[model samples]
Target: MNLSPKLLEVFTTALAVPADQITADLDYQGIPEWDSMSHMILIAELESSYAITIETDDLLEMTSVTNVVDRLKKYGIEA
Candidate 1:
């Protein structure tokens, strides 16, 4: 499971955005598509995809693609 592609897929599908538009620099709430509802959906997608539970602090810290990768790393996932 390559993390990059999986991340893109999750964000794209969850946010209803184009795959090419998602980047490491893309931040949560940085775009209209990444609203509160989409954030929860995105979290769900990520949790299901990685098969891990994210703590509240970590969930709040997941602001960008880079942040997500870093957080997942702590859970034994590498991008």
Candidate 2:
């Protein structure tokens, strides 16, 4: 899956996990840095990287690694 490199960096850093560990099935709860603050940072990071605003519905639905790609795709981002 070809994803945005900046998005990958944001997720990996925000989750405190290696980039390779990030995948479609990986849930946010599985990472330590996926807490409240991190979630906020992740949201901001995604916005900055994609140059697009994420909707509240998409924000609430972002539970797993795949969900990020999914939500962004809905906004016209290629997966």
Candidate 3:
């Protein structure tokens, strides 16, 4: 699957948000749906989808959709 679509799925499913509402500018804690619980869900979904482990610091740094894409790239994922 394409990275963007997969990311949308993760965000949509984890945060229970509409796919159309997901954008690169979408940020963690920016919405009620993206609370601490949903944040971990998003992290797990991303890790499982990318088949890569993320550092704790990276997890903490994942503040936005664009940030996720950039961090995944650091792991050699073509986001």
Candidates in order have lDDT scores of 0.86, 0.80, 0.84
Candidate 1 C-alpha lDDT tens digits along 24-64: 78888899998999999999998999899999999999988
Better of 2 and 3 by lDDT: 3
Give the top-scoring candidate (lDDT): 1
Q: Write the per-residue lDDT of candidate 2 for residues 1-79, one digit (tens) a residue.
A: 4557877898877777778887778776676757878888888888887788988999999988788888888888875
Q: How many backbone clashes does candidate 2 have?
A: 0
Q: Which stretches of candidate 2 lie over 4 Å from their true place?
A: none
Give model 3 RMSD, 1 decimal: 2.3
- 1-79 per-residue lDDT for model 3 (tens digits): 2346677787799889988778878899898998999999999998898788999989998988888888888898766
Clashes of 3: 0
TM-score of 3: 0.88
Runs off by more than 4 Å, candidate 3 = 1-3
The true-versus-predicted C-alpha distance at residue 52 of model 2, in Å, is 0.9
